[model samples]
Target: MKNLGRVTPATALVLESLLSADSVWGLQIVKDTGKKPGTVYPILERLEAAGWVQGEWETSEERKGPRRRYYRLLADARPLARDFVRAQRSKASSAVRPTPAFNEGGWSAV
Candidate 1:
């Protein structure tokens, strides 16, 4: 499997959602993570490109909506997904702090 270079917070959220699901379509993931299509699609493409996930188009004849692309995490990548989530969580926890408000003149450190 290709190693992922950087896992952004948004990407982490997408990956986290996949962990609980057997397989999911693009829009379902967007709803599950509350991420916009613009954000989620690119992340899905990245994951598919990295070989961590596989995607296929649904071919059922009874489908009612637009053909959905289903994405699934490769069996071998689940451990990596777990590790990535843990790392992202640790990184997020460490970076959590109150944001400094802007002053009248310009942006302030406080």
Candidate 2:
């Protein structure tokens, strides 16, 4: 797989969603991540371009709506995707801080 470059929070969310299943439809990922379609689609495209993901159009005619594109992480890239997701989660958790309480003078961490 090629370098994925900067992995944004949206991209991390997408990766997390993908890791949860063997294959996932793009819309399902959008719903799973609660991210906009605009945000999720591009990330999927980028992942596919980077060789980390493979997307295939649904061939079954039994389904109703528009043909859904199912995406799956390349076998060799799964471990790296997991590592990226873990790192992103670590950063996100570390970056979060409790809301500051208002003190008599000003705001305080306590």
Candidate 3:
């Protein structure tokens, strides 16, 4: 698998959503992650480029709608994705935690 480089919070959410299903359509991912199309599509693109995921068009004559592009996580990428999600969660929590602030006078709660 190629390097994923940097995964923003939105990208992390997309990866988390992908974990729940065997394969998912683009709109479904947007819905699951509560992210806009602009944000979701780029993350999917990166995952696909990194060999972490595979995407294909859905073709069903019985269904009457536009073709849906679906994505599935690569078997090799699962463990890496799990680790990434955990790390992102930990990083996010730490960012939200209060930290002490230092001033000229003294240290204070933040």
Query: Who wins the lDDT comparison?
Result: 2
* lDDT sort, best first: 2, 3, 1
Span of 10 residues, lowest total lDDT, candidate 3: 3-12
TM-score of candidate 2 versus the correct structure, residues matched by position: 0.88
Model 1: residues with Cα > 4 Å off, grouped in runs: 97-110
Score residue 108 of candidate 1 by CA lDDT.
63
Stretches > 4 Å off in candidate 2:
99-109
lDDT of 2 by residue, 1-110 (tens): 89988899899999999999999999999999999999999999999999999999999999898999999988998898899999999999999988899989999886
Better of 1 and 3 by TM-score: 3
lDDT of 3 at 10: 90
Query: How do the predictions measure up, each by TM-score?
Result: 0.82, 0.88, 0.85
Q: lDDT of each model, Cα atoms only?
A: 0.90, 0.94, 0.91
In candidate 2, the residue pairs with backbone N, CA or C atoms under 3 Å apart (3 or more residues apart, or in different chains) clash, namely none
* Residue 31 accuracy (lDDT) in model 3: 99
Give the Å shift of residue 43 in candidate 2. Answer: 0.6
